[model samples]
Target: MAQFYRLRVHHRQTGEIHDLTVASDRYILHQAEHQGYELPFSCRNGACTSCAVRIRSGEVFQPEAVGLSQELRDRGYALLCVSYARSDLEVETQDEDEVYELQFGRYFGGGRVRFGLPLEDD
Candidate 1:
């Protein structure tokens, strides 16, 4: 028998809170959509931050969530598209750009860019 868990999602943009009952075997995002909640999401394959959320309470398992780094996951970040509830959960939606920056921001503005072709100093 499949176990179901209660999920509380707080939308950061609109301050809307959605309550849902999700099966442990299903992805949280998919289940939310199936229940008529319009949550933010892009890639449903766990390859993007569009469905990122921060675990506020309880736990989720997302071993296939490649969009998140171990550090981020340790910091309570999760990709709803690939996450399965391990227990009753409370998550807050994260801004995509914010999570993206946290994931790859270090690489930005760290290298020198040569606008034109490099001139050979003969």
Candidate 2:
């Protein structure tokens, strides 16, 4: 049986509020797109953080979201492109950079780093 759940997606970047019903058997982002909502997304296969969102309420299942870490998932983050509504859901789009930072910044961003090899003396 196909189950439907209410979904409330808030676009923090655009300040758009979309309220609609989504099906548990389909990806949330696709459903929203079918309903004419243009939410941020990139790499619809769930490999990028562009579709990242934070679940403010309710539940979702995203077993294919390889872009997110278990820590981020535990922190209520999900990739809408692969997430399925498990219950009435309330989510807000997250800044991609923020999500990226949370996922990998610890290993890279550590302040100014001199780029390129030292210029050869003339």
Candidate 3:
């Protein structure tokens, strides 16, 4: 049996709020888009954090959100491109740069790159 959940989306960047019904079996982003609401997203395959949102209330299931680390997930962050509503959900879009910084800022390099292997002629 399929279940449906009410989703409340808070687009923080635009200050737009949308209330939509989403199914538990499909990607929330897809459903939201179909319902005529626009949301930030990139790399819909769950490999990027462009569609990241913060879960304010209720629960979402995101088994394929590989772009998010357990640390972020534990902190109530989710990638809407791959998330499914497990229950009535309230998610607010995160600032793209903020989420990216939180997720990968530490890994940024401050030094020049040095290659150990010589370039081969093609």
Candidate 4:
């Protein structure tokens, strides 16, 4: 039998709060979209941070969320496109830039050099 859980989403950009029921086996973003709530998303395959959210309470399983590191997942970050509700969930939508920064900001503007390029010699 499939289990259903209450999902509360707080949209930071629009200041909207959405309450919905989601099946444990379904993706939250997909469920939200089905119910006519427009959420921010770029890639629906969990390859980007456009659908990132922070888990305020409860748990989610997102084994396919490659956009987020394990460290960030441990810190309660999840990609809604690939996440499954493990229990009743409360999540706050995150800014795309904020989540991107949290994921790869350290590697940016660090004075790193490219090894293989047209203008550079190997």
Candidate 5:
């Protein structure tokens, strides 16, 4: 069965709000990337809380979140990059406040940098 995650994000800066629909099994970063949302993230793994946020409403699953202290977890802080939604959720994070869009081509070096010979061209 396919899974879906509904997210409501509140921007702390401009007080703007965004409703996002993410896949339940996929990392939140994928959703952010697909939607062109700027998330302050260094490590995409659960070791970093760069994507941390407070769960304003709903439930999420963190399978490998090590950086989240007990107090922080209790306080609703979570790493959005690693967490998967169990239900429709509302989150408040820094990303919404200072939204940034990530250019996919820049990081992957575009299609110019070849990994192997282009079979189609040959």
Candidate 6:
């Protein structure tokens, strides 16, 4: 039988709660996906820090880490895609609105152009 884990993610801005149940071996990103939560992430591996987040409570186990700084890990920051819950967890992170805005800035907004075409704007 597969073990079950409970997750409670708190959106820091709106104070919305996402309660989830996932297989013990499953990463938090999968749980977020199952719940239709648009979590910010890039590489599914621990290479990019885009999935970085702070744990408000409980603990997670990570067998491998390529991006997380030691200071962050000490302070409870984790890469959700490669971390497993060690207990019922409460995580705090920037809200969906901020993630959406970040996505827009990366894909469609002029933030990219401003950084790229300095001569055009100046």
Query: What TM-score does each of the candidates earn?
Result: 0.88, 0.90, 0.87, 0.89, 0.68, 0.69
Residue lDDT tens for model 3, 1-122? 76999999999989999999999999999999999999999899998888999999999889999999989999999999999899999989999889988987787545333477765655
RMSD of each: 5.1, 3.8, 4.6, 3.7, 11.8, 6.6
**Mind giving the per-residue lDDT tens digits that candidate 2 earns over 10-63?**
999999899999999999999999999999998999899999999999999999
Off by over 4 Å in 5: 13-15, 94-122
Q: Which has the better lDDT: candidate 4, or candidate 6?
A: 4
Considering summed lDDT, which 10 consecutive residues are worst modelled in model 4? Answer: 113-122
**lDDT by residue for model 5 (4-98), tens:** 87888785645778788987887776687789776556677867656777788988888677766666677677778788888889988755222
lDDT of 1 by residue, 1-28 (tens): 6689999999998899999999999899
- List pairs with backbone clashes in candidate 4: none
- Candidate order by lDDT, highest to lowest? 2, 1, 4, 3, 6, 5
Please name the candidate that would achieve the greatest lDDT relative to the true structure: 2
lDDT by residue (16-118, candidate 4, tens digit) is 9999999998898999999999999999999999999999999999999988899999999999999999999999999999988887878875745455564
Answer with 3 or 5, whichever has the higher TM-score.
Answer: 3
Model 3: weakest 10-residue lDDT segment is: 108-117
Worst 10 residues of 6 by lDDT: 95-104
User: Where does candidate 6 clash, by residue pair?
Assistant: none
Residue 74 displacement in candidate 4 (angstroms): 0.4
Candidate 3: residue pairs that collide: none
Total clashing residue pairs per candidate?
0, 0, 0, 0, 1, 0
> Which ten residues in a row are the worst by lDDT in model 2?
112-121
Residue ranges of candidate 1 with Cα displaced over 4 Å: 109-122
**Mind sharing the TM-score for model 3?**
0.87
lDDT of each: 0.93, 0.94, 0.91, 0.92, 0.70, 0.73
Q: Specify the highest-TM-score model's number.
A: 2
